[model samples]
Target: MKPEPSSALFAGPFALATLSTPDGPEFPALVTPDGQALDLRDVFGDERLTTLDVLDRWETALPRLRAVAADAGPARTAVTDLRVHAPVAPRQVFQSGANYRQHVIDLHVAHRAPGDERPEGERRAEAAEIMDRRAAEDLPYVFTGLPSAITGPYDDVVLPAWAEKPDWELELAVVIGKAAHRVPVEDAPQYIAGYTIANDLTDRATVFRRDMPQIGTDWLRSKNAPGFTPLGPWIVPSESITDPDDLRVRLELNGETMQDESTADMIFKVARMVSYASQTARLLPGDLVLTGSPAGNGMHWGRLLRDGDVMEGTITGLGVQRTRCVAEGAA
Candidate 1:
């Protein structure tokens, strides 16, 4: 028997709206331009949707979305008019580091190499300068954070008082759809759910200062601050992205272009990073992997974000996001 077709409605970047079902938000898929939420699980449930499961289904989902759009008539203005939210509200956000050769060079010039091991006093004195200088050099870097830091589309990023140097990192983030660990590098693409844009907010001064041996902890303290990571506006299905690695990324501050580059600059590519990370831990559905950012950050200009500063970023084909920086004490 022919099965009923499934659809999705992805509005405002990462906002995903699925069809109403007895199970509740069936498929929980990403929204589309035509006010339809691609019902991933439903599509997988139906034989007519396709034989492929979620892991390998994206390749087929694109055409399916277009077909649905054709049947729906011209897309509603609301789908194109809404704001985007984080592609996936995951349990955690994994960020990369020193992944770009240029970023490594910048770090070397500002701070010592990984093994250089500078003296305590010297390291402290150079911390701020290193962050400032390194920000100028668009070297590849990575890191990870808890899910609490995750913010939805159009959410404001709070600049804490302890953060003397709050900076922005505009990056491409990947969402995991399948449950797989230690997946071979060649097969890494099979585990992906979709993609989105992310702004990795950093507390530079606090991070370096806490790196001191006297602190007595291995983890970087600067990373734990509240509202550090702002993500979303939308989570674009992998099928929607023709070439994930080739997309162009841009960052604008108060209407001024601050960062512009393509994902082609990545030093560690997505497949390798996914394969590497999965080897140690499970990369489950809804997990977020943030690809590193390109050069051109405020830290490089010695002009970290101030209260009320508007920051925006966009990726070709995916979508754009704008955020306002609120002061620590503001009501």
Candidate 2:
């Protein structure tokens, strides 16, 4: 029971997507600026051509895609009639943490010791100063994510019974087009194929290991649950975005605005994040690099997710994805 967004999903001449009819096999697709979607089989003339295959041949396929968008004609289908899936099935997922200046500052201020009563202004200032130093002198913190956790953008998010504090984290996802290993920051853009939206759900209750305090956060349990990451309706080509840093990242909970911020608040920008990740591991085509989420998560507001809550997320030009929260084992 999802509603259509107010505007076109993406304003680009064309974008990449994965779609299928009810009970039909998923296939790579080309989406027009007007919201018409055409299966890429027409372009590839091969049933085996998948979304990742298209990404693997992005350069050779770009011109063909543009031509198709200009003349979709009779082959076009309205996007509403199709079941959209996550655009690419990545072999590897690299996610950034505490990458937003305000998000970290807010979290630091909010989680102060119970008995220690520092003035709000003073606490925020101290956190802000620390963030500034980290931004200037520290490397971006990144971690791995499981591809099995990815679900379709509009899918249901089942809150596990054991998860006491489930939360939402809407972020911009970067799709790799070229294989990059130890790539320089200036050259990171060439390795990026496109951008998509991802909602990185977390179970805050499992974030810290109470039994082994020295071991610190338990990301595997806290962040990698099945269907924890809801990703994409489409992959908007990097060329379509004039300035990724200027885009707005927003999310609404049951029609109430929750997380709303600009990419400008990021401590580590897209290019830098990609370059940093590449220095440690090779980034292959279709792999995803998730920019950290912005401030205004459920933890910040002291109101976590509940069954039947609907989360609608949107990144400027990348489109919107609506996910309903369902308690585990609900019919």
* TM-score per model over all chains: 0.71, 0.96
Give the whole-model CA lDDT for all candidates, comma-separated.
0.63, 0.90
Q: Point out where model 1 deviates above 4 Å.
A: 1-30, 34-70, 73-77, 80-84, 110-142, 209-211, 214-220
Mind sharing the TM-score for model 1? 0.71
Worst 10 residues of 2 by lDDT: 1-10
Q: What's every prediction's RMSD, in angstroms? A: 8.6, 1.6
- Against the true structure, candidate 2 reaches a TM-score of 0.96
lDDT of 1 by residue, 67-98 (tens): 55445453333433333344455765677865
Q: After superposing candidate 2, which stretches have Cα over 4 Å from the reference?
A: 1-7, 113-122
**Number of the top candidate by lDDT?**
2
Candidate 2 per-residue lDDT, tens place, 166-258, comes to 999999999999899999999999999999999999998888887887898899999998989999988999999998988999999999999
Worst 10 residues of 1 by lDDT: 1-10
